[model samples]
Target: MEESDALRAARAVRRSVLGDAYVDGQSADPDPAGREFQDYITSTAWGVWARGGALASRDRSLLVLAMTAALGRMEEFRVHAGSALRAGVTDEEIDELLFQIAAYCGVPAGVAARRVVRAVRAERGEA
Candidate 1:
């Protein structure tokens, strides 16, 4: 696809990933600390993720969700878990990722991630 078309596709997929919270997260009133740094991270992440190389989108997104969940950041993992699905990661893959992380991130963290995965799947009408 053309770059514009690719970007449009990415944006649509991004929107599905973020769900109803997209409006709240995007074009928002800036964060008090600074939105620029967040923008930088966002840009870097997107470029790395959408590069058409590196990791496959589904795997990249799944890794992100797993890493975030391992950190025990429920909300962020919740966001990324949904994003992973939109990136074409399957529910089975997500479940396995969380389960594998249990060995290192702990059972509690894995359980928490599973909860978010379930909720996300339900929201997407896939559960």
Candidate 2:
């Protein structure tokens, strides 16, 4: 892909994964190593991730939430999981995703997700 394509892909990941909390619009660093890693994340990973594949945006977001939850990164989950809902992912879908994570992301992660999901839902009157 082109450099512009790389940049666009990275931004999409940032917007969808990071929501409004990310303010680092520029590249990570000027060093070659940082550029290489960014390339890998933008071109190789995110690029190859959806190439010729067709999942709805909500599905993709759900997958991301599950993975992040598995890592026990509660802060990240609280945001992106809300983003996933905003992207049209349903509470049921998120619940299922969290269930899957519990099998892999552990009970604590799923439990934490439940609390967050509940709070966000309440904020939207979905509680």
Candidate 3:
């Protein structure tokens, strides 16, 4: 099937944020359930919403990390934390955001997010 406009746009934006290797890894041989989910989130969450705003990708990346962290979505927090780093949101910025998260979202959530951020940073050899 030909790619939909949304899918194409999503592919571009997703690549820009997550990088080619990660996106390609997720796109490989997805199960039916996974395919459906990938399609929907790519088309809607990324293609539509992530691309719709005036905020730069860097800003969006930071917001995504913070929101995922506050919700204790560890997998998503890790993914977006990596993306935020790639998008040029510094470790210092993320550290400061963790403090904000602790103030409102609770210390446990901030701690959990910090763990993910650390792992991601380690994976990328960023300290």
Candidate 4:
């Protein structure tokens, strides 16, 4: 299949934010349906990420962290949290964001996000 310019741009944005290693791992061998889904996400979701309008990539990363955490998507939360950190979001900022999440999304969500953040930090040798 020919890749559209949008898909190519989105894939580059995804690699920049999520890291080449992670993107490469995700692109490694998939069944037909899975490959289609991956392409869909790369073109759509990552396309939004690639469009830098009012929000910068770091802002988008932080927003993703909050939204994923509030939705109890811990794995996604962890991924975005790591990306947020790499995008120049401070540990203190993430800590404060957790407090905000606790206040708005409930304490459980905040706690779960903290756990994910801790694991991500540990993985990066930050903890």
Candidate topping TM-score: 4
Candidate 3 clash pair list: none
> What are the clash counts of all predictions, listed in order?
0, 0, 0, 0
- Runs in model 3 deviating more than 4 A are 30-33
Candidate lDDT (C-alpha), each: 0.69, 0.69, 0.81, 0.86
Q: TM-score of model 4 relative to the true fold?
A: 0.92
Tens digit of per-residue lDDT, candidate 1, span 1-127: 1235545444544555555476346636466445554344444555456556666778778778878887888998887876775678877887778778887889998888888888988897875
Candidate 1 lDDT (Cα, 0 to 1)? 0.69
Give candidate 4 misplaced runs (Cα > 4 Å).
none
Whole-model alpha-carbon lDDT for candidate 2: 0.69
Model 2 scores a TM of 0.63
TM-score of each: 0.71, 0.63, 0.87, 0.92
Error of 3 at 126 (Å): 3.7
Instruction: Point out the worst 10-residue segment of candidate 4 by lDDT.
Output: 28-37
RMSD values, in order shown: 4.9, 4.1, 2.0, 1.3
lDDT of 4 by residue, 63-101 (tens): 888888889999888778888866778899899999999
Native-referenced Cα lDDT, model 3: 0.81
